[model samples]
Target: MPSTSDQTLENQNDEELNSLHGKIKALRSVTIDILDDSNRQNDQLDRTGNTFTQFTNSLFSTSRHHSRSMAASSTVRQYRTIAYIVGAVVLLWLVLKLWSFGGTRSVPPDGVNGEYRI
Candidate 1:
């Protein structure tokens, strides 16, 4: 049988120990929650990284496609311009040839009296 004061002191010590244990359990629970949150964040980061990579690849692919098309369009425009210039030059040359061929001829100094010449 202990004295009343000793029993009171023992009860106080038990209460303090129980409180410490409860706090420890709560702290451990919080730690586990933090770890779970970090893991979830890590998973989200991985997904975001993959998405960014895919987006970058898609942009590059689109850029390449656009660049190729633009290059082809530029080439086509150049060819069309050259064709137009060549066509115009050919048309001018043909006109000049026809003009020279159709020029007036001078009369012959001696005229023939044969039927074909007349």
Candidate 2:
């Protein structure tokens, strides 16, 4: 009877050791899965950051081009206004000179109030 009881105790110890080993294996698998998920999340964040940087750079470039174009257009407008002012001044001077002539005729070269005609 004592031998039989010793054998039963040994069997229970073996069963408990196997159960503990299986539980340890399950914990290890769970830890590995968590690490994989973390790595994946970090990679996704890096991609998103890169994409945002590219978008911002493109937007900045477009705005710079537009600003330069607007500055050139403003310069052209200023030149056009100056040209118009000069043309108007010239026209006014011509009109004034013509009015002074007053449809008058030129005197003949052959002596009008002269003692001798050259």
Candidate 3:
């Protein structure tokens, strides 16, 4: 059997409690929304990072292939130059040797003073 004044005070306390509860619920809802937005941002960042990685990988692979092709082309050119140089040297040597062998005059068929004629 509470007095009227005590009952009024209890009612005021109950109203205050309800008000605090409502504020707590509103804060919780706002916090949840913020967390959800943060998660979405994180997911988007992950996707962007993956896409960048893939692009870089492709670029690197293409560059590697190009480098290899250029190296091969350089090697072929070097080999061809060396072959041409070697062939030219060999041809010059053969021509010089043949000229030296063929240029010496042999003894003439008619003898003059017992010496062969040029």
Candidate 4:
């Protein structure tokens, strides 16, 4: 039979081993969780990168289209500018004509026959 002290020592060793095992299991669970979180973050980053790329491509295409349209319509743009200037001139002329037509009238003096009233 084992001595009483030896039994006590064995029990203590068993308890310590169980505690160490529990700690190891906890560490393994935490490591797995970390790996899962990292994978999710990587997937999200990839999706974001792809979305940004698509948006950039769309923006570039729109800018190119706008540039082409502007280049092609330069004559139209010039005509529009001239029309704006002519419209402004016509509006100014109309305003001046109306103002002159509505000129102020001279009022007669306040008198009975030819002598002014006191």
- Candidate 3 per-residue lDDT, tens place, 26-110, comes to 9999999999999999999999999999999999999898678667787887678679999999999999999998977676656
TM-score of every candidate relative to the true structure:
0.58, 0.55, 0.59, 0.63
TM-score for candidate 1, residues paired by index: 0.58
lDDT of 1 by residue, 15-77 (tens): 999999999999999999999999999999999999999999999999898678767787878
lDDT of every predicted structure (CA atoms): 0.88, 0.87, 0.91, 0.90
lDDT of 4 by residue, 62-94 (tens): 989867876788888968867999999999999
After superposing all C-alphas onto the true structure, candidate 3 shows an RMSD in angstroms of: 32.2
* Better-scoring candidate (TM-score), 2 or 3: 3
Could you list the CA RMSD of all candidates, in the order they appear?
32.5, 33.8, 32.2, 21.9
TM-score of 3: 0.59
The C-alpha stretches of model 3 lying farther than 4 A from their native spots are 74-118
lDDT tens digits, residues 1-117, model 2?
Answer: 569889999999999999999999999999999999999999999999999999999999998986786677877876786799999999999999898888655654555564433
Which candidate model has the greater TM-score, 1 or 2? 1
Q: Which pairs, if any, clash in model 3?
A: none
- Can you rank all candidates by lDDT, best first? 3, 4, 1, 2
The 10 consecutive residues of candidate 3 with the worst lDDT sum are 109-118
| Candidate 4 clash pair list | none
Worst 10 residues of 2 by lDDT: 109-118
Candidate 1 runs further than 4 Å off = 75-118
